[model samples]
Target: MAQAPDHAPDHSGEALVIQKVQPFGEGQIVLTTPSLDADGRLEDRHSAYHENRSPPLVWTPVEHVAAYAIVVEDPDAPREHPFVHWLIWNIPGEATSLPEGLPNEASLGLIGGATQGVNGAGKIGWFGPRPPPGHGLHRYHFQIFALAERLTFGPNVPLETLVSALKGDTLAEGLLVATYEAPESQ
Candidate 1:
Protein backbone atom coordinates (compact mmCIF):
# COMPACT_ATOMS: atom_id res chain seq x y z
CA MET A 1 0.00 0.00 0.00
CA ALA A 2 2.97 2.28 0.46
CA GLN A 3 3.57 2.18 -3.27
CA ALA A 4 3.14 5.86 -3.88
CA PRO A 5 1.23 6.83 -6.99
CA ASP A 6 2.25 9.59 -9.31
CA HIS A 7 -0.57 11.70 -7.92
CA ALA A 8 0.24 12.54 -4.28
CA PRO A 9 3.74 12.64 -2.79
CA ASP A 10 3.33 14.04 0.73
CA HIS A 11 1.53 11.46 2.85
CA SER A 12 2.07 13.17 6.22
CA GLY A 13 4.01 10.08 7.32
CA GLU A 14 4.45 6.60 5.96
CA ALA A 15 1.66 5.06 8.02
CA LEU A 16 2.41 1.60 9.31
CA VAL A 17 -0.92 0.28 8.08
CA ILE A 18 -0.13 1.55 4.61
CA GLN A 19 3.26 -0.03 4.84
CA LYS A 20 1.75 -3.44 5.60
CA VAL A 21 -1.08 -4.09 3.20
CA GLN A 22 0.02 -5.31 -0.22
CA PRO A 23 -1.05 -3.57 -3.38
CA PHE A 24 -4.13 -4.89 -5.15
CA GLY A 25 -4.13 -7.33 -8.09
CA GLU A 26 -3.98 -5.02 -11.07
CA GLY A 27 -5.54 -1.93 -12.63
CA GLN A 28 -7.00 1.00 -10.68
CA ILE A 29 -10.27 2.76 -10.39
CA VAL A 30 -10.18 6.52 -10.45
CA LEU A 31 -11.33 7.76 -7.04
CA THR A 32 -12.48 11.33 -6.61
CA THR A 33 -14.23 13.40 -3.96
CA PRO A 34 -15.95 16.72 -4.12
CA SER A 35 -15.80 17.19 -0.35
CA LEU A 36 -12.24 18.51 -0.58
CA ASP A 37 -11.19 21.99 -1.59
CA ALA A 38 -9.28 22.67 -4.77
CA ASP A 39 -6.04 22.28 -2.87
CA GLY A 40 -7.14 18.81 -1.65
CA ARG A 41 -7.64 19.91 1.93
CA LEU A 42 -10.57 18.30 3.73
CA GLU A 43 -13.40 20.69 4.52
CA ASP A 44 -14.16 21.79 8.09
CA ARG A 45 -17.59 20.18 8.09
CA HIS A 46 -16.09 16.85 7.14
CA SER A 47 -13.93 16.90 10.23
CA ALA A 48 -14.47 15.36 13.67
CA TYR A 49 -13.67 18.72 15.24
CA HIS A 50 -16.56 20.26 13.37
CA GLU A 51 -19.66 18.74 11.81
CA ASN A 52 -18.07 15.27 11.80
CA ARG A 53 -19.70 14.27 8.56
CA SER A 54 -18.54 11.69 6.00
CA PRO A 55 -17.56 13.02 2.64
CA PRO A 56 -19.18 12.02 -0.62
CA LEU A 57 -17.02 9.97 -2.98
CA VAL A 58 -17.12 9.21 -6.70
CA TRP A 59 -15.13 6.70 -8.68
CA THR A 60 -14.79 5.12 -12.05
CA PRO A 61 -17.41 2.40 -12.25
CA VAL A 62 -16.46 -1.12 -13.27
CA GLU A 63 -18.25 -4.23 -14.45
CA HIS A 64 -18.09 -7.85 -13.31
CA VAL A 65 -16.71 -6.90 -9.93
CA ALA A 66 -18.09 -8.54 -6.81
CA ALA A 67 -18.02 -5.58 -4.36
CA TYR A 68 -16.04 -2.58 -3.14
CA ALA A 69 -14.71 -1.42 0.23
CA ILE A 70 -13.66 2.01 1.44
CA VAL A 71 -10.94 2.38 4.05
CA VAL A 72 -9.88 5.85 5.19
CA GLU A 73 -6.74 6.31 7.24
CA ASP A 74 -4.57 9.11 8.54
CA PRO A 75 -0.90 8.22 8.15
CA ASP A 76 0.45 11.24 9.98
CA ALA A 77 -1.13 10.44 13.35
CA PRO A 78 1.29 9.62 16.16
CA ARG A 79 0.10 6.05 16.47
CA GLU A 80 1.46 2.55 16.00
CA HIS A 81 -0.08 2.62 12.55
CA PRO A 82 -2.23 4.81 10.42
CA PHE A 83 -5.42 5.92 12.17
CA VAL A 84 -8.50 4.51 10.48
CA HIS A 85 -11.17 7.12 10.02
CA TRP A 86 -13.71 5.00 8.22
CA LEU A 87 -14.32 1.32 7.39
CA ILE A 88 -17.15 0.58 5.01
CA TRP A 89 -17.60 -2.46 2.81
CA ASN A 90 -20.07 -4.51 0.80
CA ILE A 91 -20.81 -1.60 -1.47
CA PRO A 92 -22.50 -2.91 -4.59
CA GLY A 93 -20.08 -3.29 -7.46
CA GLU A 94 -22.49 -1.46 -9.73
CA ALA A 95 -22.21 1.69 -7.67
CA THR A 96 -19.86 4.44 -8.73
CA SER A 97 -20.27 6.88 -5.89
CA LEU A 98 -21.51 7.28 -2.34
CA PRO A 99 -23.82 10.08 -1.27
CA GLU A 100 -22.79 12.53 1.45
CA GLY A 101 -23.76 12.39 5.14
CA LEU A 102 -24.03 8.63 5.53
CA PRO A 103 -25.42 7.83 8.97
CA ASN A 104 -23.11 6.35 11.59
CA GLU A 105 -24.63 2.91 11.77
CA ALA A 106 -23.28 -0.61 11.50
CA SER A 107 -25.35 -1.91 8.60
CA LEU A 108 -26.16 0.60 5.91
CA GLY A 109 -29.36 -0.73 4.42
CA LEU A 110 -29.84 2.37 2.35
CA ILE A 111 -26.78 2.03 0.16
CA GLY A 112 -26.91 -1.36 -1.49
CA GLY A 113 -26.59 -3.24 1.79
CA ALA A 114 -23.23 -1.81 2.67
CA THR A 115 -21.99 -2.57 6.18
CA GLN A 116 -19.68 -0.34 8.19
CA GLY A 117 -16.92 -1.59 10.44
CA VAL A 118 -15.62 -0.07 13.64
CA ASN A 119 -13.39 2.91 13.08
CA GLY A 120 -10.16 3.70 14.90
CA ALA A 121 -12.23 5.45 17.60
CA GLY A 122 -14.17 2.18 18.06
CA LYS A 123 -17.16 3.87 16.54
CA ILE A 124 -19.16 2.44 13.65
CA GLY A 125 -19.07 4.11 10.24
CA TRP A 126 -17.14 7.19 9.26
CA PHE A 127 -15.25 9.05 12.01
CA GLY A 128 -14.06 12.28 10.57
CA PRO A 129 -10.49 13.50 11.08
CA ARG A 130 -9.63 14.87 14.55
CA PRO A 131 -5.86 15.10 14.33
CA PRO A 132 -4.23 16.31 17.51
CA PRO A 133 -4.26 20.03 18.09
CA GLY A 134 -1.10 21.69 16.73
CA HIS A 135 -0.24 18.38 15.09
CA GLY A 136 0.49 20.22 11.88
CA LEU A 137 -1.36 18.24 9.17
CA HIS A 138 -2.43 14.66 8.51
CA ARG A 139 -3.10 13.11 5.15
CA TYR A 140 -6.20 10.94 5.03
CA HIS A 141 -6.01 8.21 2.41
CA PHE A 142 -9.46 7.29 1.20
CA GLN A 143 -8.80 3.90 -0.33
CA ILE A 144 -11.41 1.80 -2.09
CA PHE A 145 -10.51 -1.80 -2.63
CA ALA A 146 -12.31 -3.89 -5.19
CA LEU A 147 -13.02 -7.36 -4.02
CA ALA A 148 -13.45 -10.47 -6.11
CA GLU A 149 -16.34 -11.59 -3.94
CA ARG A 150 -18.42 -10.50 -0.97
CA LEU A 151 -16.83 -10.80 2.44
CA THR A 152 -17.93 -13.82 4.45
CA PHE A 153 -18.26 -11.90 7.71
CA GLY A 154 -21.30 -10.13 9.01
CA PRO A 155 -21.79 -6.61 10.38
CA ASN A 156 -19.41 -4.59 12.55
CA VAL A 157 -16.16 -6.12 11.29
CA PRO A 158 -12.86 -5.28 12.97
CA LEU A 159 -9.92 -3.55 11.30
CA GLU A 160 -7.42 -6.34 11.74
CA THR A 161 -9.87 -8.93 10.52
CA LEU A 162 -10.59 -6.90 7.47
CA VAL A 163 -6.91 -6.49 6.77
CA SER A 164 -6.34 -10.21 7.12
CA ALA A 165 -9.26 -11.05 4.89
CA LEU A 166 -8.17 -8.67 2.16
CA LYS A 167 -4.59 -9.80 2.11
CA GLY A 168 -3.77 -10.11 -1.59
CA ASP A 169 -7.47 -10.59 -2.35
CA THR A 170 -8.01 -7.08 -3.64
CA LEU A 171 -8.86 -7.18 -7.27
CA ALA A 172 -8.14 -3.50 -7.63
CA GLU A 173 -8.03 -0.24 -5.68
CA GLY A 174 -8.86 3.40 -6.09
CA LEU A 175 -7.56 6.15 -3.86
CA LEU A 176 -8.47 9.74 -3.08
CA VAL A 177 -6.03 11.64 -0.90
CA ALA A 178 -6.93 14.60 1.31
CA THR A 179 -5.32 16.40 4.22
CA TYR A 180 -6.60 17.79 7.54
CA GLU A 181 -5.19 19.57 10.58
CA ALA A 182 -6.67 20.59 13.90
CA PRO A 183 -6.65 24.28 14.70
CA GLU A 184 -3.71 25.19 16.88
CA SER A 185 -5.84 27.42 19.08
CA GLN A 186 -8.45 24.76 19.56
Candidate 2:
Protein backbone atom coordinates (compact mmCIF):
# COMPACT_ATOMS: atom_id res chain seq x y z
CA MET A 1 0.00 0.00 0.00
CA ALA A 2 2.69 2.47 -0.94
CA GLN A 3 1.82 5.83 -2.43
CA ALA A 4 3.44 7.54 -5.42
CA PRO A 5 4.97 10.98 -5.40
CA ASP A 6 2.72 13.84 -4.27
CA HIS A 7 2.20 15.14 -7.78
CA ALA A 8 0.69 13.72 -10.96
CA PRO A 9 2.59 12.50 -14.02
CA ASP A 10 2.39 14.00 -17.47
CA HIS A 11 -0.21 12.06 -19.43
CA SER A 12 1.32 12.90 -22.80
CA GLY A 13 3.10 9.79 -24.00
CA GLU A 14 4.76 11.59 -26.87
CA ALA A 15 6.18 14.15 -24.52
CA LEU A 16 7.32 11.48 -22.13
CA VAL A 17 8.65 9.09 -24.72
CA ILE A 18 10.36 11.49 -27.07
CA GLN A 19 11.60 14.30 -24.90
CA LYS A 20 11.73 13.08 -21.33
CA VAL A 21 12.55 9.41 -21.77
CA GLN A 22 16.27 9.44 -22.42
CA PRO A 23 18.25 6.26 -22.70
CA PHE A 24 21.96 5.85 -23.46
CA GLY A 25 23.37 7.07 -26.81
CA GLU A 26 21.45 6.10 -29.91
CA GLY A 27 20.47 2.78 -28.35
CA GLN A 28 17.34 0.92 -29.41
CA ILE A 29 16.11 -2.60 -28.80
CA VAL A 30 14.18 -4.32 -31.58
CA LEU A 31 10.80 -4.94 -30.05
CA THR A 32 8.49 -7.35 -31.84
CA THR A 33 5.28 -9.35 -31.48
CA PRO A 34 3.35 -12.10 -33.30
CA SER A 35 -0.02 -11.03 -32.02
CA LEU A 36 -0.75 -8.25 -34.47
CA ASP A 37 -2.40 -8.78 -37.84
CA ALA A 38 -0.67 -8.45 -41.19
CA ASP A 39 -1.51 -4.75 -41.26
CA GLY A 40 -0.09 -4.32 -37.77
CA ARG A 41 -3.54 -4.08 -36.23
CA LEU A 42 -4.22 -5.38 -32.77
CA GLU A 43 -6.63 -8.23 -32.27
CA ASP A 44 -10.11 -7.74 -30.86
CA ARG A 45 -9.22 -10.18 -28.10
CA HIS A 46 -7.05 -7.46 -26.57
CA SER A 47 -9.81 -4.88 -26.68
CA ALA A 48 -11.10 -3.47 -23.45
CA TYR A 49 -14.67 -4.36 -24.27
CA HIS A 50 -13.70 -7.83 -25.42
CA GLU A 51 -11.35 -10.31 -23.84
CA ASN A 52 -9.34 -7.50 -22.23
CA ARG A 53 -6.20 -9.56 -22.30
CA SER A 54 -2.58 -8.65 -22.91
CA PRO A 55 -0.90 -9.59 -26.16
CA PRO A 56 2.32 -11.54 -26.16
CA LEU A 57 5.42 -9.35 -26.50
CA VAL A 58 9.08 -10.02 -27.19
CA TRP A 59 12.20 -7.91 -27.48
CA THR A 60 15.81 -8.27 -28.45
CA PRO A 61 18.07 -8.59 -25.46
CA VAL A 62 20.20 -5.61 -24.51
CA GLU A 63 23.61 -6.16 -23.03
CA HIS A 64 24.37 -5.51 -19.36
CA VAL A 65 20.79 -4.55 -18.57
CA ALA A 66 19.62 -5.37 -15.07
CA ALA A 67 15.91 -4.70 -15.62
CA TYR A 68 13.31 -3.50 -18.12
CA ALA A 69 10.15 -1.39 -18.12
CA ILE A 70 7.30 -1.04 -20.59
CA VAL A 71 4.62 1.53 -21.16
CA VAL A 72 1.81 1.11 -23.69
CA GLU A 73 0.17 4.35 -24.79
CA ASP A 74 -2.34 5.71 -27.30
CA PRO A 75 -1.52 9.22 -28.45
CA ASP A 76 -4.66 9.38 -30.60
CA ALA A 77 -7.26 9.39 -27.89
CA PRO A 78 -9.86 12.20 -28.02
CA ARG A 79 -8.35 13.64 -24.90
CA GLU A 80 -5.62 16.27 -24.84
CA HIS A 81 -2.80 13.76 -24.57
CA PRO A 82 -1.96 10.08 -24.83
CA PHE A 83 -3.93 7.44 -22.98
CA VAL A 84 -1.95 4.78 -21.14
CA HIS A 85 -3.21 1.25 -21.68
CA TRP A 86 -0.51 -0.50 -19.73
CA LEU A 87 2.02 0.60 -17.14
CA ILE A 88 4.29 -2.27 -16.24
CA TRP A 89 7.79 -2.38 -14.75
CA ASN A 90 10.42 -4.46 -12.97
CA ILE A 91 10.94 -7.00 -15.72
CA PRO A 92 13.97 -9.23 -15.26
CA GLY A 93 16.86 -8.53 -17.57
CA GLU A 94 16.86 -12.11 -18.78
CA ALA A 95 13.25 -11.99 -19.93
CA THR A 96 12.93 -11.85 -23.68
CA SER A 97 9.26 -12.70 -24.05
CA LEU A 98 6.16 -11.86 -22.07
CA PRO A 99 3.40 -14.44 -22.24
CA GLU A 100 -0.05 -13.32 -23.35
CA GLY A 101 -2.87 -12.58 -20.92
CA LEU A 102 -0.80 -11.63 -17.87
CA PRO A 103 -3.09 -11.23 -14.90
CA ASN A 104 -3.97 -7.62 -14.02
CA GLU A 105 -2.29 -7.38 -10.69
CA ALA A 106 0.72 -5.91 -8.90
CA SER A 107 3.69 -8.11 -8.16
CA LEU A 108 3.90 -10.88 -10.76
CA GLY A 109 5.61 -14.03 -9.50
CA LEU A 110 5.83 -15.66 -12.88
CA ILE A 111 8.39 -13.02 -13.93
CA GLY A 112 10.43 -13.13 -10.78
CA GLY A 113 8.28 -10.84 -8.66
CA ALA A 114 7.99 -8.07 -11.21
CA THR A 115 5.71 -5.20 -10.23
CA GLN A 116 3.13 -3.17 -12.13
CA GLY A 117 2.42 0.52 -12.31
CA VAL A 118 -0.90 2.33 -12.61
CA ASN A 119 -2.47 2.78 -16.01
CA GLY A 120 -4.49 5.76 -17.29
CA ALA A 121 -7.54 3.83 -16.13
CA GLY A 122 -6.19 4.19 -12.56
CA LYS A 123 -5.68 0.47 -12.30
CA ILE A 124 -2.73 -1.89 -12.09
CA GLY A 125 -1.52 -4.03 -15.06
CA TRP A 126 -2.67 -3.94 -18.65
CA PHE A 127 -5.98 -2.32 -19.66
CA GLY A 128 -6.37 -3.13 -23.33
CA PRO A 129 -7.37 -0.61 -26.00
CA ARG A 130 -10.88 0.90 -25.68
CA PRO A 131 -10.78 3.93 -27.93
CA PRO A 132 -14.18 5.50 -28.54
CA PRO A 133 -16.27 3.82 -31.25
CA GLY A 134 -15.79 5.34 -34.72
CA HIS A 135 -12.91 7.38 -33.41
CA GLY A 136 -10.77 6.36 -36.31
CA LEU A 137 -7.65 4.30 -35.65
CA HIS A 138 -5.45 4.69 -32.60
CA ARG A 139 -1.75 3.98 -32.48
CA TYR A 140 -0.56 2.07 -29.49
CA HIS A 141 3.11 2.70 -28.77
CA PHE A 142 4.56 -0.08 -26.72
CA GLN A 143 7.75 1.45 -25.39
CA ILE A 144 10.40 -0.50 -23.49
CA PHE A 145 13.21 0.80 -21.31
CA ALA A 146 16.29 -1.19 -20.53
CA LEU A 147 17.73 -0.28 -17.20
CA ALA A 148 21.38 -0.64 -16.27
CA GLU A 149 20.47 -1.56 -12.72
CA ARG A 150 17.60 -3.07 -10.83
CA LEU A 151 15.51 -0.28 -9.29
CA THR A 152 13.64 -0.40 -6.02
CA PHE A 153 10.96 2.24 -5.58
CA GLY A 154 8.04 2.87 -3.33
CA PRO A 155 4.72 1.33 -4.31
CA ASN A 156 2.13 3.00 -6.56
CA VAL A 157 4.89 4.60 -8.66
CA PRO A 158 3.47 6.72 -11.45
CA LEU A 159 4.82 6.62 -14.98
CA GLU A 160 6.70 9.83 -14.29
CA THR A 161 8.38 8.39 -11.25
CA LEU A 162 9.49 5.34 -13.16
CA VAL A 163 10.68 7.52 -15.99
CA SER A 164 12.50 9.64 -13.48
CA ALA A 165 14.19 6.63 -12.01
CA LEU A 166 15.28 5.61 -15.49
CA LYS A 167 17.08 8.87 -16.14
CA GLY A 168 20.63 7.60 -15.83
CA ASP A 169 19.96 3.89 -15.36
CA THR A 170 18.49 3.37 -18.84
CA LEU A 171 20.85 1.42 -21.03
CA ALA A 172 18.51 1.54 -24.03
CA GLU A 173 14.92 1.67 -25.14
CA GLY A 174 12.69 0.45 -28.00
CA LEU A 175 9.16 0.18 -29.22
CA LEU A 176 6.65 -1.93 -31.17
CA VAL A 177 3.80 0.18 -32.47
CA ALA A 178 0.40 -1.40 -32.99
CA THR A 179 -2.85 0.05 -34.30
CA TYR A 180 -6.46 -0.45 -33.24
CA GLU A 181 -9.81 0.95 -34.40
CA ALA A 182 -12.94 0.45 -32.41
CA PRO A 183 -15.98 -0.84 -34.29
CA GLU A 184 -18.36 1.84 -35.49
CA SER A 185 -21.56 2.35 -33.56
CA GLN A 186 -24.51 0.13 -34.45
Candidate 3:
Protein backbone atom coordinates (compact mmCIF):
# COMPACT_ATOMS: atom_id res chain seq x y z
CA MET A 1 0.00 0.00 0.00
CA ALA A 2 2.95 2.28 -0.63
CA GLN A 3 4.03 2.36 -4.23
CA ALA A 4 4.51 5.60 -6.12
CA PRO A 5 7.92 4.96 -7.53
CA ASP A 6 7.68 3.08 -10.74
CA HIS A 7 10.25 5.52 -12.15
CA ALA A 8 9.16 4.65 -15.70
CA PRO A 9 11.77 3.34 -18.09
CA ASP A 10 10.96 0.51 -20.39
CA HIS A 11 11.56 2.21 -23.72
CA SER A 12 9.72 1.55 -27.04
CA GLY A 13 7.27 4.43 -26.81
CA GLU A 14 8.26 5.04 -30.41
CA ALA A 15 11.85 5.16 -29.25
CA LEU A 16 10.75 7.90 -26.79
CA VAL A 17 9.71 11.53 -26.89
CA ILE A 18 7.54 13.15 -24.29
CA GLN A 19 7.14 16.87 -23.61
CA LYS A 20 4.98 17.98 -20.72
CA VAL A 21 5.81 21.34 -19.22
CA GLN A 22 3.19 23.56 -17.60
CA PRO A 23 4.89 26.68 -18.88
CA PHE A 24 5.91 27.63 -15.36
CA GLY A 25 6.20 23.96 -14.63
CA GLU A 26 7.48 22.73 -17.97
CA GLY A 27 9.65 25.65 -19.16
CA GLN A 28 9.49 29.34 -18.45
CA ILE A 29 12.51 30.03 -16.32
CA VAL A 30 10.98 32.88 -14.42
CA LEU A 31 13.13 34.74 -11.89
CA THR A 32 11.15 37.94 -11.53
CA THR A 33 12.46 41.45 -10.74
CA PRO A 34 12.01 44.15 -13.30
CA SER A 35 10.14 46.53 -11.02
CA LEU A 36 6.70 45.66 -9.66
CA ASP A 37 6.45 45.85 -5.95
CA ALA A 38 3.44 46.45 -3.66
CA ASP A 39 2.34 43.04 -4.78
CA GLY A 40 1.98 44.71 -8.12
CA ARG A 41 5.40 46.19 -8.72
CA LEU A 42 8.52 44.06 -9.13
CA GLU A 43 7.95 43.03 -5.51
CA ASP A 44 11.31 43.02 -3.86
CA ARG A 45 12.02 40.74 -0.96
CA HIS A 46 15.76 40.87 -1.35
CA SER A 47 16.02 39.61 -4.84
CA ALA A 48 19.69 39.01 -5.26
CA TYR A 49 18.57 35.55 -6.38
CA HIS A 50 15.99 32.83 -5.90
CA GLU A 51 12.54 32.81 -7.50
CA ASN A 52 12.24 29.59 -9.35
CA ARG A 53 15.91 29.88 -9.10
CA SER A 54 16.19 26.22 -9.83
CA PRO A 55 12.74 25.08 -10.89
CA PRO A 56 12.56 25.28 -14.67
CA LEU A 57 13.90 22.11 -16.17
CA VAL A 58 13.01 19.88 -19.16
CA TRP A 59 14.44 16.99 -21.22
CA THR A 60 13.71 14.74 -24.22
CA PRO A 61 16.89 13.91 -26.15
CA VAL A 62 17.58 10.32 -25.40
CA GLU A 63 19.86 7.72 -27.00
CA HIS A 64 21.21 5.69 -24.16
CA VAL A 65 20.78 8.09 -21.29
CA ALA A 66 23.17 6.70 -18.78
CA ALA A 67 22.11 9.01 -15.97
CA TYR A 68 20.02 11.97 -14.88
CA ALA A 69 17.91 12.35 -11.77
CA ILE A 70 16.57 15.31 -9.83
CA VAL A 71 13.93 15.51 -7.15
CA VAL A 72 12.97 18.68 -5.32
CA GLU A 73 10.01 18.35 -3.02
CA ASP A 74 8.13 20.66 -0.71
CA PRO A 75 4.56 19.45 -0.49
CA ASP A 76 3.69 22.51 1.57
CA ALA A 77 6.27 21.62 4.13
CA PRO A 78 5.12 21.26 7.72
CA ARG A 79 7.17 18.15 8.13
CA GLU A 80 5.98 14.69 7.22
CA HIS A 81 7.47 12.99 4.11
CA PRO A 82 7.13 15.58 1.40
CA PHE A 83 9.98 17.75 2.50
CA VAL A 84 13.04 16.67 0.63
CA HIS A 85 14.27 19.99 -0.61
CA TRP A 86 16.53 18.58 -3.29
CA LEU A 87 18.31 15.46 -4.51
CA ILE A 88 20.28 15.03 -7.71
CA TRP A 89 21.06 11.70 -9.35
CA ASN A 90 23.57 11.60 -12.18
CA ILE A 91 22.16 13.95 -14.86
CA PRO A 92 23.86 13.87 -18.26
CA GLY A 93 21.68 13.04 -21.20
CA GLU A 94 22.96 15.75 -23.49
CA ALA A 95 21.45 18.12 -20.92
CA THR A 96 18.53 20.46 -21.45
CA SER A 97 18.06 23.31 -19.00
CA LEU A 98 18.64 23.81 -15.25
CA PRO A 99 19.86 27.37 -15.06
CA GLU A 100 19.06 29.46 -12.00
CA GLY A 101 21.81 29.31 -9.40
CA LEU A 102 21.08 25.56 -9.35
CA PRO A 103 22.56 23.27 -6.79
CA ASN A 104 24.88 26.22 -6.42
CA GLU A 105 27.04 25.96 -3.38
CA ALA A 106 29.46 27.22 -5.96
CA SER A 107 28.67 25.60 -9.31
CA LEU A 108 26.22 22.99 -10.62
CA GLY A 109 26.20 23.34 -14.39
CA LEU A 110 23.46 20.73 -14.65
CA ILE A 111 24.38 17.51 -16.44
CA GLY A 112 25.57 14.03 -15.56
CA GLY A 113 28.59 15.70 -14.05
CA ALA A 114 26.21 17.27 -11.54
CA THR A 115 26.24 16.25 -7.88
CA GLN A 116 24.21 16.86 -4.73
CA GLY A 117 21.52 15.32 -2.54
CA VAL A 118 20.30 16.55 0.81
CA ASN A 119 18.22 19.63 1.13
CA GLY A 120 15.26 19.89 3.52
CA ALA A 121 17.56 22.26 5.43
CA GLY A 122 20.18 19.56 6.03
CA LYS A 123 21.96 21.68 3.46
CA ILE A 124 23.95 20.24 0.60
CA GLY A 125 22.89 22.51 -2.23
CA TRP A 126 20.11 25.01 -2.68
CA PHE A 127 17.82 25.58 0.32
CA GLY A 128 16.19 28.88 -0.40
CA PRO A 129 12.57 29.90 0.36
CA ARG A 130 12.05 29.44 4.04
CA PRO A 131 8.32 29.50 4.68
CA PRO A 132 7.16 29.27 8.25
CA PRO A 133 6.59 32.73 9.55
CA GLY A 134 2.85 32.39 9.24
CA HIS A 135 2.93 29.32 7.12
CA GLY A 136 0.65 30.72 4.49
CA LEU A 137 2.29 30.37 1.14
CA HIS A 138 4.46 27.38 0.54
CA ARG A 139 4.54 25.35 -2.61
CA TYR A 140 7.99 24.48 -3.83
CA HIS A 141 8.24 21.56 -6.19
CA PHE A 142 10.92 20.82 -8.75
CA GLN A 143 11.22 17.39 -10.23
CA ILE A 144 13.19 16.23 -13.23
CA PHE A 145 13.77 12.56 -13.65
CA ALA A 146 15.39 10.83 -16.61
CA LEU A 147 17.48 7.77 -16.26
CA ALA A 148 18.09 4.63 -18.21
CA GLU A 149 20.90 3.67 -15.84
CA ARG A 150 23.79 5.38 -14.08
CA LEU A 151 23.69 5.98 -10.35
CA THR A 152 25.70 4.91 -7.36
CA PHE A 153 23.78 6.62 -4.52
CA GLY A 154 26.90 7.53 -2.60
CA PRO A 155 27.61 10.62 -0.51
CA ASN A 156 24.18 11.14 1.11
CA VAL A 157 21.18 9.45 -0.47
CA PRO A 158 18.54 10.94 1.72
CA LEU A 159 15.11 11.71 0.21
CA GLU A 160 14.09 8.18 0.97
CA THR A 161 17.05 6.53 -0.68
CA LEU A 162 16.66 8.77 -3.68
CA VAL A 163 13.02 7.74 -3.98
CA SER A 164 14.01 4.16 -3.56
CA ALA A 165 16.69 3.84 -6.18
CA LEU A 166 14.40 5.62 -8.65
CA LYS A 167 12.26 2.53 -8.83
CA GLY A 168 12.12 1.23 -12.41
CA ASP A 169 14.86 3.44 -13.86
CA THR A 170 12.62 6.37 -14.93
CA LEU A 171 13.15 7.32 -18.51
CA ALA A 172 11.93 10.91 -18.64
CA GLU A 173 9.97 13.28 -16.47
CA GLY A 174 9.99 17.02 -15.74
CA LEU A 175 8.23 19.36 -13.36
CA LEU A 176 8.60 22.77 -11.69
CA VAL A 177 6.64 24.69 -9.08
CA ALA A 178 7.75 27.67 -7.02
CA THR A 179 6.25 29.66 -4.20
CA TYR A 180 7.60 30.92 -0.89
CA GLU A 181 6.62 33.28 1.87
CA ALA A 182 8.12 33.64 5.33
CA PRO A 183 8.05 37.23 6.36
CA GLU A 184 6.78 38.05 9.79
CA SER A 185 9.91 38.69 11.74
CA GLN A 186 10.54 41.48 14.16
Top-TM-score structure, candidate number: 2
The lowest-lDDT stretch of 10 consecutive residues in candidate 2 is: 7-16
Q: Report clash pairs, candidate 1.
A: none
- Writing each residue's lDDT as its tens digit, candidate 1 over 126-148 gives 89999888768788989888887
RMSD for each of the candidates: 6.6, 6.4, 16.8
Query: Model 2: clashing residue pairs?
Result: none
Task: Give the local distance difference test score of model 2.
Answer: 0.82
Position 129, candidate 1: lDDT: 91
Candidate 1, TM-score vs. the true structure? 0.86
* Comparing 1 and 2 on lDDT, the stronger one: 2
Error of 2 at 50 (Å): 0.7
Q: Which stretches of candidate 3 lie over 4 Å from their true place?
A: 1-68, 73-84, 88-116, 120-141, 156-171, 183-186
RMSD over all Cα atoms, model 2? 6.4
lDDT of each: 0.81, 0.82, 0.52
Query: In candidate 3, where is summed lDDT lowest over 10 consecutive residues?
Result: 9-18
lDDT order of candidates, best first?
2, 1, 3
